[model samples]
Target: DVGCGYEAARQMRRRGRIAPQHWPHVVAASRRLGIAGVSYEWLAGRAAMQRAAVMQGEAA
Candidate 1:
């Protein structure tokens, strides 16, 4: 059965046997936690959205 590749990547990293391909998935894995990610533009967009939301809240 298929398993969690990101979890595998994490274990591999802990064991010092990670591969380059595992990086993006691993990085994206904890993105919401802001631990890491592969999307620079996505992060920027999220920041912009949050900023706008805060500004709107202030204007309310």
Candidate 2:
């Protein structure tokens, strides 16, 4: 699922890790799969802090 991949990417980014550079591929895949409301920029913007909060079980 695109949503799952996106979340995994976000988590990878959060841990100061390097995920494969697959944004464009993911975007295309999402579009083909009819996954709507997927904004890469927005996801990237919030990823680090969001992941931190989620990992810690609290608001960032």
Candidate 3:
């Protein structure tokens, strides 16, 4: 899900990426999704766990 990156992901306006104005909400959304934290490694680990859970659900 793009969430707030829909426009950027689609390359709307030729930016092909998120604009500066969207940073705050993007970071907020990332935090809410458990993908952002005090440590980059922590975030990666959490994301891996979440991804595995999602894939497991799909397999089920």
Q: What C-alpha lDDT do the candidate models reach, one value each?
A: 0.57, 0.63, 0.58
Per-residue lDDT over 2-50 for candidate 1, one digit per residue giving the tens place of the 0 to 100 score: 1356687578658554344544554566564576444645545655776
Clashing pairs in 3: none
Estimate the lDDT of model 2. 0.63
Candidate 1 collision pairs: none
Q: How many clashes does each candidate structure show, in the order listed? A: 0, 0, 0
**Candidate 2 C-alpha error for residue 4, in Å:** 14
Checking candidate 2 for backbone clashes, the offending pairs are none
In lDDT terms, which candidate is top? 2
lDDT of 3: 0.58
Tell how far residue 41 is off in model 2, in angstroms.
1.3
Model 1 — which ten-residue stretch has the worst lDDT?
17-26
- For model 3, how big is the CA root-mean-square deviation? 9.8
Tens-digit per-residue lDDT, 1-60, candidate 3: 325555565673463334445546656677777874634454456557767888999999
Ranking by lDDT: 2, 3, 1
Scored by TM-score, the top model is 2
Question: Which model, 2 or 3, shows the larger lDDT?
Answer: 2
